[model samples]
Target: MPAVTVDSTLELPRVPVPPAEGTRQRPVLSVTTAPRGFEGEGFPVHRAFAGVAQRDLDPFIHMDQMGEVEYAPGEPKGTPWHPHRGFETVTYMIDGEFEHADSHGGGGRITDGATQWMTAGSGILHIETPPEHLVLSGGLFHGIQLWVNLPRANKWNPPRYQSIEGGQATLLSSPDGGALVRLIAGDVAGHRGPGSTFTPITMIHATLRPGAQLVLPWRADFNALVYSLSGRGSVGEQGRPMEASQLAVLGGGDALSVAASARPDERTPDFDVLILGGRPIREPVAHYGPFVMNTREELVQAFEDFQAGKMGAIPAGKMPHTAPGEQRPV
Candidate 1:
């Protein structure tokens, strides 16, 4: 398959979710930042990572509540370059634009609403810089960069990628209102997320219409979280509304369900939510920076191998040296 690039006029899909049955429980919205040690623009993320869903939310590790940011020209930050290992870094662009190049001979640019799914198997070195059109010209640079862990068995397979641009993504309408829902991955309303997934996970992008009631199922066995991108709505049946920048938590059961209704008098426009959850991985997780391993011994060997040039050497001047794999010849 070929790489999918994004254009300025591309429109992202807006699919609406339907109201589910049952007197479900409400979700607990919590504010979380990255752990104390790591320091970067990506720290102190708005929600959970290695917290309540650490081992429970397998496949998915954490989501970096990325930008809806409007950066000034030459501001402190516009775009960024980073490295990764043992997982997949998926970027869902909503506004602005982003261009990236990696050691795997993969490079491309995608604008708002495109999904970039990159799997850093053994290791990978890459730089992601935002498009000057949006950054320099002063527009919104909005999106989410989610971290999905590779299962113990699939971790070292190979570094690869697949992406779905603004086109090809499905757009479904709310059964009643003008609201919409978009599927970045997994199946909803009979339309499976575009492209293929290495794991059985589902990610839905949804909006709430006034007084709209929506109830959805949760895999009791899988851990899940509903992230409020913009708007107000209470999760589950617990009874309380979660505003912007908060994440609501729901535990695993034989199955799970969420019920919510939009507040009519609320000034918020359509309440946007990025619903993410997945099956749990009960295996041991030895994580350090970008690499995640099953055993401490394996983790130790990985470090030694990286230092001795086993995976591969890092490019000339990158700090910390996270990548340890051969780059495809350009």
Candidate 2:
């Protein structure tokens, strides 16, 4: 929960309150709780986008809320070397540290509040793992990995990477000085974040003090969603209950709101949420284990190309160190 913060919200620039009369407050369409699961190398994760309709999540293929768990010494784990195509992977590290390396020469360390954005456009091979020291002396590890679907036209663009440091995010406050909004990508109220995106989208991590409300003017063309990261809260004017690991898909409107309950869950003192929206791609989607494409034929071709080594080769002497008893990928 210490992704980014300020000693006092009163010191930050304020997000102006939307006019009440002219703007429509988005209604909550549905609220779903993420089911727990284990991800790469047996790390815990919550499948945040589960049970949501594909149309509603268009331009966003999948997401996983990787552990709010505290790990003991020698227990940290990460993904094996894998190939991906036709999409982008955004890894935001909220607490612990993760190291990323790819076949296309894109690699970096993403730690506390930083983000590593990798566009696996066309095709690429990559690996994400806790650093050796973190592996030896385990600590809290929490983060999110979101898969952003690329439009058919841009799916084949050359691979690229961006390392956005924690302090790079645009920080703003609620007019009442009750919330802190960290803009990681896209524009909000004419203020832009650091990460550039192929798809038009906005990603914000906002924290609201107990009983505080955060309202933002939203783009009418983009679909909106709010996912609770910690504590208890409510979404929309109707006051749909929201808690940790719950996602609320909002109906069409000119603005959106989220409020923390006066009595938040004991786990956290404030309610934190991830608010995101993107212009719908509105194209057919064919997704598999690691590839997202517009058609089954393209997915098949992606696998063939990957197996044929067209994605790129592992760097010399830099093969990922496999865990004991873990099988190596072919």
Give each model a TM-score.
0.77, 0.97
The candidate maximizing lDDT is: 2
- Residue 94 Cα positional deviation in candidate 1, in Å, after optimal superposition: 1.6
What is the total number of backbone clashes in candidate 2? 0
lDDT of 2 at 19: 95
Give the per-residue lDDT digits (tens) of candidate 1, residues 214-277: 4554455456777777666666656556666666666543323233354533645556777886
- Candidates in order have lDDT scores of 0.59, 0.91
- Estimate the Cα RMSD of every predicted model relative to the unseen true structure: 6.3, 2.0
Residue 260's lDDT within candidate 2 is 96
lDDT of 2 by residue, 13-66 (tens): 899989999999999999999999998779999999999998998889999999
